[model samples]
Target chain A: AQSVAQPEDQVNVAEGNPLTVKCTYSVSGNPYLFWYVQYPNRGLQFLLKYITGDNLVKGSYGFEAEFNKSQTSFHLKKPSALVSDSALYFCAVRFRPGYSSASKIIFGSGTRLSIRP
Target chain B: EPEVTQTPSHQVTQMGQEVILRCVPISNHLYFYWYRQILGQKVEFLVSFYNNEISEKSEIFDDQFSVERPDGSNFTLKIRSTKLEDSAMYFCASTPPGHSTNNEQFFGPGTRLTVL
Candidate 1:
C-alpha cells in the first residue's frame, strides 16, 4: 500500500518570508509525488509533481517542491510567501497505473497554510 | 487552456432521494474521475472512468453509487440514496493520455451537495 503524511496541521509564515510545507510518503515502489492547493469553496488546484526528473519541480503560482528520495519526502516551498498563497495544501502519491488511470492518486491529510501580513 | 467544469455549484436534497452530479471534462482528456471531501476532512477518491467504463473505485464507492459517460462531453455520478454523511463537496477531474504524476489533472470548481 502507498500513503502520504503531512506532519503539520497548519503553518504560519510572514508575507515575503520563505515557506515550506512538509510531506513524506510510504510506498513499495518508486514514489510519484504531487502537491495541490485549495482555496475556500474551490476545487483542488495542481501545483507541481515529481515523476522522474531533477530533484526540484516548480509549479503554478511560483510554488515549488523538492523530491528527496532518500528522505521519502516531497516538501513544497515558496521563497517569498504571498497572502494570496494561503490555502490548504495536499500531498499526493500516484498509484501504480496498472494499464489504467483509475485510482490514480491518494492524498495526504492536508496542511493549512496562512500568510501573515 | 480549456478546463473541466461541473454543474449545480450547490445541491440540497432530502435523504433517500436520488441525485446526479454532472461534469464536462476537458475536450482532449482521456481519463475522468470523481472525488469527495466531507466537511473539514481529507479529499477522498470515489471512482475513475475511461473508455466508457469504470477503471477504478475506492471502497467508499458502494452499491449506491454509479458513474456514466452518457455523452461524449458529459460524465455523471449518480447516488441512488443519499445519506446525511454524504453531504460534502464533490469534485470532478480529468487527465490527458500518458499516465504519471506529471500528467496533472484539471479539476472543476466542484458541486457542494448537502443531504438532509
Candidate 2:
C-alpha cells in the first residue's frame, strides 16, 4: 500500500524566516507526491506536486518543494515565512496501480505550521 | 475561476440514521472523489467516481456507504446507517481529464458530520 509520512506534528517559525515542512513517502513504483494546505474551517488547497522532471517543483504562494528519489522525500519550503502562511500542511501520495489515473490519494497525518509575526 | 462547492457545512445525525452529503464539482471536471478526516487523523480516501461509476474505493468505504451522481451536476455520498465512529469532516474533490497522473484535484470546503 502507498503511504505518506509527515513526521512533524507542529513546526514553529518566526516571521520572515525560512520554513521547511518535511515529507516522506512509500510506494511500489515511482511516486506522485503532492502538498496541500488547509486553514481553519476550509478545504484542502493544492500547493504543489512532483510527478517527474526537475527535482525542484515550485507551487502557489511562493512555495516550493524538492523531490529526492533516493531519500523518497518531497519537502515543502518557503524562502521567507509570513504570519499568513500559518496553516495545516499535508503531504499526499497518489496510488496509481499500473500508472492509472483512476486512483485514490493517501494523505499524511498533517503538520501544523505556526509562523509568529 | 470555478471551484467545487459542498452543501450543509455541518451536519448532526443520530446513529442508525441515513445522511447524504452533497457536492457540486468544477464544471469541467471529469473525475470526482470523497475523502474524510477524523479530528486528529490523516485525510483518508473513501471512494472515487467517474462516468457515474466507482473507479476505486478504500477498505473504509464498506457496504454502508454509497455514491451517486443522479443528475449532471450534483455528486453525493450517502451513508445508509451512520455510526458513532462516522463522525468526521467529509471533503469532495474533482479533477479534469488529462494524460496520465499529472492532474491535481480541486477540493471543496468540507462538511463536518457528527453522529451522535
Candidate 3:
C-alpha cells in the first residue's frame, strides 16, 4: 500500500514572499509523485510531477518541487507568492515497480495555501 | 488548448434513484477515469477505463457502479442507487497513451451530485 502525508493543514504567505507546501510519502518501491491545485468548487489542476530525472522538477504556474529520496518528501515551492495562488494543493504518490497493473494512486489530505496581499 | 469536458454541472437525485454522469474526454486520449470527492475528504478513484474496457477499479466501485464509453468520445459513469453519502463532486479525467513518465491525467470541471 502507498500513502501520502501533508504535514500542514494550511499555510499562509505574504505576496512576493517564497512559499512552501510540505509533502511526504511511503511507498513499497520507486514513487511517482505529483502536485495538483484546486480552487473552490473546481476540479484539481495538475501542477507538476516527479518521475526519475532531476531531483528538482518544475511545473505549471511558476511552481516547482524537490524530490528528496532520503526524506521521502516532495515539497512544493514557489519563488514568490501571489494572491491568485491561494488554493488547495494536494500531493499524490503512485508506486511504479515492474509495471504492475494493480498499482493505484494515492493522494494526501491536501494543504490549503493562502496568500496575503 | 484542448481539455476534458463534463455535462450537467450539477444534478439532484432522490434516494434509490439511478443517475448517470457524462464526460467527453480529449479527442486523442486513450485512458479515462472517474473520481469522487466527498466534502472535506480526499479524492478517491472510482474506476479507470482503457481500450473500451475497465482496466482497474477500486473497492468503492461495487456492483452499484458501472462505466461505459458508449460512443467514440463520451465516457459515462452510472450509479444504480443514490444515497445521502453519495452526494459529492464527481470528476472525469483522461490521459493520452504511451507516456509512462509522469502519466499526467487531465481532469474536467466536475459535476456536483446532490442526493436528497
* TM-score of the second chain for every model: 0.96, 0.98, 0.96
| After superposition, candidate 1 runs with Cα above 4 Å error | A97-103
Q: Rank the candidates by lDDT, best first.
A: 2, 1, 3
Indicate the TM-score of model 2. Answer: 0.97
| iRMS per model in Å | 1.8, 1.6, 2.5
B47-99 per-residue lDDT for model 2 (tens digits): 98887888888899999999999898999999999999999999999989873
Model 2 C-alpha lDDT per residue in residues A1-117, reported as the tens digit of each score: 788999999999999999999999999888899999999989999999999999999999999999999998999999999999999999999865553347678899999999998
Cα misplacement distance, residue B101 of candidate 3 (Å): 6.0
Worst window of 10 by summed lDDT in candidate 3 chain B = B95-104
Off by over 4 Å in 3: A96-104
TM-score of each: 0.97, 0.97, 0.95
Evaluation by lDDT, superior candidate among 2 and 3: 2
Collision count of model 3: 0
Per-residue lDDT tens digits of candidate 1, residues A29-95? 7788889999998899999888887999999999999999889999999999999999999999977
B41 Cα displacement, candidate 3 (Å): 1.1
DockQ of each: 0.67, 0.71, 0.52
Q: lDDT per residue, candidate 3, A1-117, as tens digits? A: 789999999999999999999999998777899999999988889999998989999999999999999999999999999999999999998643353332345789999999999
